[model samples]
Target: IAARLVISQRTAQGHVEHILSKLGFTSRAQVAAWVVEERQSSS
Candidate 1:
């Protein structure tokens, strides 16, 4: 996914860390679950 975005892996990882910290999430799974729930609700 980072490659596809044309960003370095480290950059992508940093972005993920920033997102997790801002959202108060401990893991990617929690973020993914929240995204899915949000999408479902919007639809």
Candidate 2:
């Protein structure tokens, strides 16, 4: 994500942390699952 965004690794990690907290998710796996679900629904 950092490479794609042209940001530092720590910045990417901070964004992930913000997302997790905002979404009330406790794990990356849960975040991944939510992303998949969102994509499927959007499609």
Candidate 3:
């Protein structure tokens, strides 16, 4: 989301952390996979 939003790398990292905490995910890879799955489903 931060990448798409054109935010800095550090900001993106922060967003990833927040997302992981909110979603109960332990890894950024899991969050990335979820984002991909979500986009595919929405499309």
Candidate 4:
């Protein structure tokens, strides 16, 4: 994501962590699972 966005890896990680915190997630896997569910539901 950092490479695609032209940001430092640490910066990308920080953004992801912040988002997960706001959404009550403790790990990236949780976020990934939620995203998959959300997309499936929307579809």
> How much lDDT does each candidate structure score?
0.94, 0.94, 0.88, 0.94
**Taking the tens digit of each residue's C-alpha lDDT, what string does model 4 give over 1-35?**
99999999999999988998899999989888989
Per-residue lDDT of model 1, residues 1-43, tens digit only = 7999999999999998998999999899998999999999999
Which prediction has the highest TM-score against the true structure?
Answer: 4
**Candidate number with the higher lDDT (1 or 3):** 1
Per-candidate Cα RMSD to the true structure, in Å, reads 2.4, 3.0, 4.8, 2.4
Cα error of candidate 2 at position 10, Å: 0.4
TM-score-better candidate, 1 vs 4: 4
Candidate 3 — which pairs collide? none
Give lDDT for model 2: 0.94
> What TM-score does structure 4 among the candidates reach?
0.69
Model 2: CA > 4 A from native: 33-43
- TM values, all candidates: 0.64, 0.67, 0.52, 0.69
Each prediction's total of clashing residue pairs, residues at least 3 apart in sequence or on different chains, is 0, 0, 0, 0
Off by over 4 Å in 3: 1-19
Report residue 24 deviation for candidate 3 (angstroms): 1.2
Considering TM-score, where higher is better, how would the candidates rank from best to worst?
4, 2, 1, 3
CA lDDT, candidate 2, residue 9: 100
Q: Is candidate 2 or candidate 3 better by TM-score?
A: 2
